[model samples]
Target: MTDAFVAALPKAELHVHLEGTLEPEMLFALAARNHVELPWPDVEQARAAYTFTGLEHFLPLLFRAASVLRTRQDFYDLARSYLTRAAADGVRRAEMFLGVQTFLDAGTPIGDQLDAVLAAISDARTDLGIDGALIVTSQRHRTQAAALEVLELIEPWRDRLLGIGLGAAERGNPPAKFADYYATARARGYRTTIHAGEDGPPEYVREALDICRADRIDHGVAASADPDLMARLGDEAVPLTVCPLSNVALRVVPSMAAHPLPAMMAAGLLVTVNSDDPPYLGGYVNDNYQAVHTDLGLDRPALADLARNSFRASFDDPHRIAAHLAAVDAHVRANQPPERAYRAASAAR
Candidate 1:
């Protein structure tokens, strides 16, 4: 499919991190605004440092950039910028993960951070017509008690939050570590998602399901390693927010062509394409869609399926989800060639 077609397709972004959306220019701007000194002297140098060998290599830089976000206004600008970009890329609904615990530990009040981010979401809904909500993600490397503390901390704004997520280095911090945390979040009526299988094993994905009872799995490409896991994901229709560019950028896979997304689709899994951390990872949602279409041989119809899957996998209301899915169908019908359109319509059946 053409890049234009992919960009025009209606979709939802379910796995973006607000901190990770910090563009180099904005990083420099925010750093300057907050009177913070960055190690990189220029934007080009900052961009150059985006290279990474793995998630461990990438996270330090991610958190370091976050250091510039010292005020409520800083968080507002970051969230607004990301929502604007997501809207431009035709994202109808976005569930963004904010590293609340990071800032909470930094001594920024939870109310200050949520106030700024929720304000951005409100403005995005009004200005861009792009609806979204925040997911307060806890760092996995930290202790489970710390995660539970975060859970308790977010109780005040539980109504504004879409869910809870576990992020960061996943190797040693298994999903089971957050089981009690997720249990408490669920008990309090918050949906749960866990970052599994990106830097961790397939067993971590299992724990994310069995132990944490995660409503969704982020970077769950590791599920492809176990045939049983693949079957279970397909049968259960557990949504996986797979970030193709992030996988390649972080060396989770050798390259985009080597990503297991195609295999996951073959196994009938409910997989949605996302930009985990676009600025650091190389591309946004549209870029991920374009990469798959070019490198993985996903045709126009297949790309549309990815878009539809995005809405289907979202935590948005059922009525909104149906409308977005219908919008995707209409977009495909209008954009694709007549023969391709007919084939796509048939394929949906």
Candidate 2:
């Protein structure tokens, strides 16, 4: 059911991390290509090492995987790989997150990384027919001063870069800490989104919306816990990019059943399913769609609503978004219900 359901659905991806797209196979290949040494003995060992207990436990592995990305070609290759794979999963557009601070800290030339990634996105558009955009995400664990530096550096590529973003550990790095940075980005006419309520309290989500002025909220499932915030989000039509597999992988929720996606949707809040750090979490956007459908008991129309929300939440041009939304509706109208798809899949198995 899951496989067949996703094979026909197309959606936009908002919360995917380009650096997190580094599959173990590519990680080994890139490390060797750049003459860098990796801590893992083999690709299999690195793949086995993705068991993340929490954000702190997972960050080290994410950093280690990103270490191989020392050149522009490496970044370009990484983007190309992710886009091609995402396209196969019926993704027509992707707004990806890249933590440039990580590369700068490693002493790599920032232009080399940016130029490569931006070029790769251009290539994907022409070559793979997938529209892609970049959002330079600042490391939350770093100082807001450092985030301002990121804004300054990305100023030159203002036309190419989509917007400024905040990511990394959310425990101590509250959204309000970067209030000035978000204001700066908005003043410069760039869109913004922040990591909020993933591992933080609902107040963080509120701060992200009111203070940081996020154009959208990422992993805002925690917003469900606060009625006022939920009502506000629904009233404002704010979009929450939810990553179910990632939540389960990081133990953000006890299990998929415990995920508040259904409740959040019931609350009238706009929600879209995404695969955050797909390779690390053992799933992609399709895998996430499948899991939510099965675990949450969402049928085709419900799933179609998710697809509609994704395109609507995307940074696509309004006309393009309308076209994508129409495509989603057309597919949903043509496909069988999820239950029959599941029964067919079971028979094949």
Candidate 3:
């Protein structure tokens, strides 16, 4: 269908990274504001440097842009920009990922970081009427002890958080490495999800479910390779936050045409389309939805299914989720245009 129709559809974004939301303009502005030294001389140079072979190559770029965020307002401005953009894209709720270790390692005070993020969340709600929550994520490259330290830091700010998660490269650091970390978060009643099968095998998907007991799986597209794994994901109704553009941008698949979203849908997997890193990869939530609709040759009904799945897979409460889903269904009903009809008189003339 048309991009305008897709843009009007209500949805929720579940896989966005705050650091990944750093646009080139914001990067340079924040750098100048914070007086941070830079490797790139100008914004155009920084934007052109977004090219990458894979996630391994992208991590350094992510960190380099992230270096500009030093003070609490830096974090606040970063989050506020993302939330405002998300709101413009019809995102009713944005469950964003923030690896606090990035700021902590940069020597930004932990409390300052948390306070700034929370303030931005509150600002999004009050200013834009968009519900935003943070899922405090840990970098899997680090030790499990470090993961626990993040959990410990989040304890006081639990009211401000939606859950805890782990994400980074998936090859060497399996989801099982943070089993106890997940357990502690779970015990404290935090909803959990972990990255699996993005670059790892299907076995990592199983570990995330069985060991980590994750509420969802991020980029579990590799499950398409094994029928049994696909069946398990379908049967369990586990939500997979699939980022089509990000995957293609990172060469996870050859291109959007080769994405497994259609297969995952055929297998009855609860798949939600999201923008993992919008600014770096380009586009936001609605942009991702539109891209998949075109690349997969999906029609209105299929797009609606994906849009509804966004709310269904979200961490929002029952009333809000129900309202969003109903709104999506309503939009689908109203927007499905009719086909061309023949006019006998006009044809004769």
Candidate 4:
């Protein structure tokens, strides 16, 4: 698709973090509002500090950004801002990840955070026409009991929450570490996904599938390294919410051009692109799509397929998913070149 068409196509985002969407300007503003002091004196300095050697290196700053968000209005504002931007980018639906551990650690009640965030999402949907849901993500570094506690807190809002997710540092704490929590979530009838194979190895992806019973794999880039895993993923048609910019920013991959997305697609894996941590990674969904298209040379059809997979991979209701997919299909068809015109153009070339 042309740039304009790509930009206009209705899309869904399955792997974005609400806290990570905290832009530097908003961070400072919220910090000041809460009477909290930030480590960076200015926006540029805060932007500079976003550079990270790894996920662990980034967590401190990530937590610091969360520190400023102390009240219900703060969470509401954060969700509203993200939803507004997402709607502007043609996002018809979004399943946003919100890490609760940091807020809980800071002494904020989990119920208050959930209520405020959900309230903001509800308001944004009404005002902005953006359909979205929340995913309460548990930190991998924390114990399974901690994750279970989060699930308990989320139980009341289960209808609104898409599901529970495993996030944060993924290196040593494999999916197996949270097997019981995930199983409990599944037994409770919650949809599940986990972060694996971005910083961790392919084995982690396997564990996420087998042990944690993940329905989707987030950042399953390293699955390309293992032929068995790749085949299994393809056979299962498991969706991978690949975040190209997040990989580059976290140094999981050397650069955007070298991202494994193209390779994963070529291997017949179900791959979808996303902006995992948009603000920290330097862009949002459209920026990520453009980067992958330019750097990886993804063709228009492939790009449309990625867009389709985004909705398919999402946890939105079936009726809503159908509507979004129909929109994407309509956009693709309307924007497609005529067959005869394409033939003539090819002959002329």
Candidate 5:
């Protein structure tokens, strides 16, 4: 019953990476189509190689799979496939992050990437009935100058992009380094989100908020370590786009049972569950919802709240957000089993 409620609940996915969505099956197909040689000869072998010691270990492998995406159609197919899956998972709105700098560095034209993705988004909205937007993510491993260059290059498509984001290795690369880039993005009217605290320290989360002024913090699990930071996040009602399966896959947390999502919510922060890299991490949004429910012992109400939080944290328009929130409420109210409804009525009495 809980599973059915979650699968049909209206929700928004706010932290997925487009390049990271490249599945092994699609990876091999694109490799053959583009005449690129993959490190793994077969899909089974590629799937077997997904183990990672940490974020650093996983990035190189992600980049290798991304190499197969060389054409505009490659990106179109990638976005379309992921959007289809997201719709099935009950994602009403999706804000996907694409690391534009990597493709630029690889010599793929910016127009080819953006045009294909935007086209996919437009078609998906029409065909799948899932509204979608893109966040042109700049790789943190690169210099701030490079990030600025990317910001400028994307200016032509600014109206199409939902926002700008900082992603990739966050260890030595602090959020402070991209302050100017973020400031510039904001000056140009782009919503800014930063990846922090997944692998970096609590200080990184602080910098993201105090320095970058991030509209949302992605993977802010580390903020739990600092009482003041957690309190500030709560007081500010800052949104943390938390990814349970991705955290475990990257070893940010030992397992789903040990995830800090429950505590994050308990602290009053606006926390939303997402599948950061669905294919690479072994789950999508609904999978993350079920994992937290089973492993963390979150009840149906808690799961519903998480779904509501997702819609609230999204960058979609206000009317749409309200409508989606209403939909979530309706689904929860309609799906309650008799026993649970009786309990709620009894508690109210």
Candidate 6:
């Protein structure tokens, strides 16, 4: 589709972290309200600090920014703000990741945070027309028991919460570390996804599938290094939520132009573009789309496929998925001049 059409097509985000969307302004405001001290006194300094050598460098700052979220209202406002922006970006359905372990580390009550965020999601759906679901994520750096504690805490809100995920540093702590927790979550009927092969190796992705039983893999970029694993992902049709800006910012890849998104797509993997931590990573969902399209030289049909895969990989109801896919198809058919499509794609790049 044309760049404008791609930007306008209704969509769903299956892999965004609620904490990661904390913009600098929101962070300062929340810190002031909660009486928390921030290392950066101004937004510019905070923005500068977003430049990272890797995920390890980014995690401490992410955790520190999260410290300002002390009250239920803080959580509610954070979620509502993101949902509002997502709606404006043409996201009709979103399944957001909530890093409860961060809150728990800061001494905030898990139940309070979940109640507040879930309440705001419900309100946003009614008022803003944005349908959202929560995915409570476990920090892979922590013990499996800690992950299980998060699952139990979220048990009451099971219907509103969509799934369980393993996020955070994916280096030493492989998916095997959280196998039992994911197993329990799966047995309880929760959907599963995990962070693997982003900074970790292809073996990590395998463990996520074989041990943790994850139905989806987030940032499985390193799968390209293993032909067997890549083939398995394509054959199984497991979706990979690839975040272009996040990868570039964290130096997981040298640059956006060098990203493996197109290759993964060509391999028949259900690759979906996402913004892992948009504000912090310097872009949102559409910005990610634009960056990858520009950098990887994606055409109209390839761009359409990415948009289509987004909804297809989402946990939204089948009817909603069909409706959004119809919108994408209509946009593609209406904007099919190959030359103009190429020019528009180049400009977007």
**Cα-based TM-score, every candidate:** 0.97, 0.95, 0.95, 0.95, 0.97, 0.94
- Candidate 4, residues 246-306, lDDT tens digits: the string is 8999998999887878878888888988899898985899988888888888877888889
TM-score of model number 3: 0.95
Residue by residue across 69-159, what tens digits does model 3's lDDT show?
Answer: 9999998999999999888888899999988898899999888887898899998899998999989999999999999999888788887
lDDT of model 1, residue 190: 91
Model 3 alpha-carbon drift over 4 Å, by segment: 338-349
State the C-alpha lDDT per candidate. Answer: 0.92, 0.90, 0.89, 0.88, 0.92, 0.88
Mark the regions of model 6 whose C-alpha exceeds 4 Å error after superposition. 1-3, 337-349
Q: Each candidate's root-mean-square deviation in Å? A: 2.2, 4.5, 4.1, 3.0, 1.8, 4.3
Q: Which lDDT tens digits does candidate 2 get at residues 1-349?
A: 4567676698999999999989999999998998889989998988889887988899988997798898878888999999999888889989999999999988877788789989988998998888999999999999999999988888878988888789999998899999999999999989999999999999999999889989999999888889999999999999889999999999999899999999998988889999999999858999999998888888778888999999989877999999999999778655867796687668889
| Candidates 1 and 2 compared by TM-score, better number | 1
* Clash-forming residue pairs, model 2: none
lDDT of 2 at 67: 86
Per-residue lDDT over 96-202 for candidate 1, one digit per residue giving the tens place of the 0 to 100 score: 99998778767788888999999999999999999989999999899999989888888889888999999999999999877889999999999889999989999
Ranking by lDDT: 5, 1, 2, 3, 4, 6
Say which prediction, candidate 1 or candidate 6, comes out ahead on TM-score. 1
Scored against the true structure, residue 335 in model 3 reaches a CA lDDT of: 70
Deviation in angstroms for 234 in model 2? 0.6
* Regions of candidate 2 where Cα sits further than 4 Å from its true position: 337-349
Q: What are the clashing pairs of model 6?
A: 294-349
| Clashing pairs for predicted structure model 4, backbone only | 1-300
